[model samples]
Target: MFHTAICDLLGIRYPIIQGAMQDAGGPRLVAAVSEAGGLGVLPTFGGTEAALRADIEKTSKLTRRPFAVNITPIGRAFTESRAAICIEMGVKIVTTGRGDPGLSIVEKMKAAGIVVIPVVPSVAHAIRVEQEGADAIVASGSEAGGHVGRVSTMPLVPQVVDAVKVPVVAAGGIGDGRGFLAALALGACGIQLGTRFIAAQESEASDWVKQRIIAARETDTIVSSLMTGKPVRALSSRILSAYEAERARCSDEQERAAARGRFLSELRDAARDDRTYAAGEISGMIRGIAPVRDLIEAIINDAAALAEKLHALAGRS
Candidate 1:
């Protein structure tokens, strides 16, 4: 079996981590990943303290294996509270993104014997978190779904690996065994996959959402700030298309303001008419939905076989 720092640190058999997606990383998905020998992270965004605790309890009841919980620390008011709750619940890992959770939160998690993995968008941020005692860094690139950084995974992984002492987990545009092997070649110890897991049968996403992902092309995802106040990558749905069309036609401030109102209205109820299947460019590579265990095993086994073949070819040369 393959092993890395992430596997050792997180106490998992595989170094694969299911990237924490808001609303998608619920108890069902989280428990399945952990049971399948990978780390599953429960996302704590857009939920209350009581709700978050209940989700944690549910995941804990489902699996005894180690799992993580993610918190967005940039603008969220209850970041510290969430961290405290994770620690209190004996979560094995805590992943922070968007921005650093400051030294206090990092130190607290570290002191509580929890590994801290921070998702970063740049080499600078990776180094900063490593210095702040982050056990590992997730080098999330622009190709990822939802909020992403400017760098692509191809360049960002190696850059972050070279700059930081901690283990780096590559994120973005990774779907199958080829992508897993590529990340290892780029000097990453592990991988955090968001889009790939969205199509998994265990995911909380609706069938319509999963079908939309399965039907999407490489160019179907667009990054826009219209959905949320901040820029996020989402499927190019009818709602997003309508919003863009209206904005282009608006010539004056009065028309622009009217378009903005209509845009927000459509975005709020997008699921009814135009579902926003927030996903990454890797959606193009996904073919079918399978159980989390089967998917993870397939990726690991395929990558292993490819590595063996490469080694044999290199020896002959």
Candidate 2:
């Protein structure tokens, strides 16, 4: 019912997007969200082109609704191949991250008639993406899981919305209907949530990972660059502590590089074992995992009720 420019552009029923969490946002989660009227995005970070195609096929089988693929431009060749796969699979939308999706990439996708939504962390990034012909921009704040910028959603969303002419999707600590309503009030056309979806039953994350998020409080999640040489928000754990300690002991560039490499290796191992890594402060607000359909319904129902109350208050005034 909360349709906006984003929902119209992406052909989704609601202006909600499930942030593509690495290793967690796979076929099941993507399909579930799409089937529930929200746009779900599959993260294409863990597999090859063939694997991505197979996952896309499986997701198609699971849900007749539209879905998207997220590809962070970490390595040039890998990202290029992933983009090709997305196009080949007839993906209606592609979310780019980590780098500037240059004109060429945007042009190629656009020529294929695919909607290109780039994730930006600042007003500057949003402007740049808009100029590059992105169909929309997802303004991710520091409160978001994984690599993030310095600004939080409250200020960042409006700034990005004002900076770009294209539709803006707010991303970060948003978890529930209140967050979604707040985003709309801030001029955002849509909301994308990561941590909230991690707690959903369709998420690929392990049960232990979900339990950690459920038990965490607002202050429990920390933002640190010790893991991947970039600022990322995640749960504070023994591994993070160790990585911090090692970084502190290394003063020279060479020592720091070696320490960072070691930390990254450990993080990769943890990801492989289905351990929790990236999470947002919204974890504090999460109670338990539910089926994707129920989760979406609850969010919409709560949002509708809140809107009605606000409308009644306006009449009284």
Highest-TM-score candidate: 2
lDDT of 1 by residue, 1-317 (tens): 77998898889999899999886779999999999999999998778889889989999999999989998885535888998898898888899878889988889889999899999999989988999999899999999998888899999999999998888999999988889999999999989999889989999988878888898899999876566656678888777777777777889878877777878886786665475656999998888889999989998999999999999999999
Cα lDDT of model 2 overall?
A: 0.87
How big is the positional error of residue 289 in model 1, measured in Å on the Cα after superposition?
0.9
In candidate 1, stretches whose alpha carbon ends up further than 4 angstroms from where it belongs are 74-76, 242-262, 271-273
Clashing pairs in 1: none
Per-residue error (Å), model 1, residue 287: 1.2
Going through the candidates in the order shown, the clash numbers are: 0, 0
Model 2 error, position 290 (Å): 0.6
Residue 302, candidate 1: alpha-carbon lDDT? 94
Per-residue accuracy of model 2 over 1-317 as CA lDDT, tens digit each: 78788888998998899988887889999999999999999887667888788889999999999899998887768877888888888999999877775788788888999999999888988888888889999999888888898999999999999888999999999988888888988999989989999989989988888988999999888777875577889988767777778878888989988888887778778753333389998999999999988988888888889989989999999
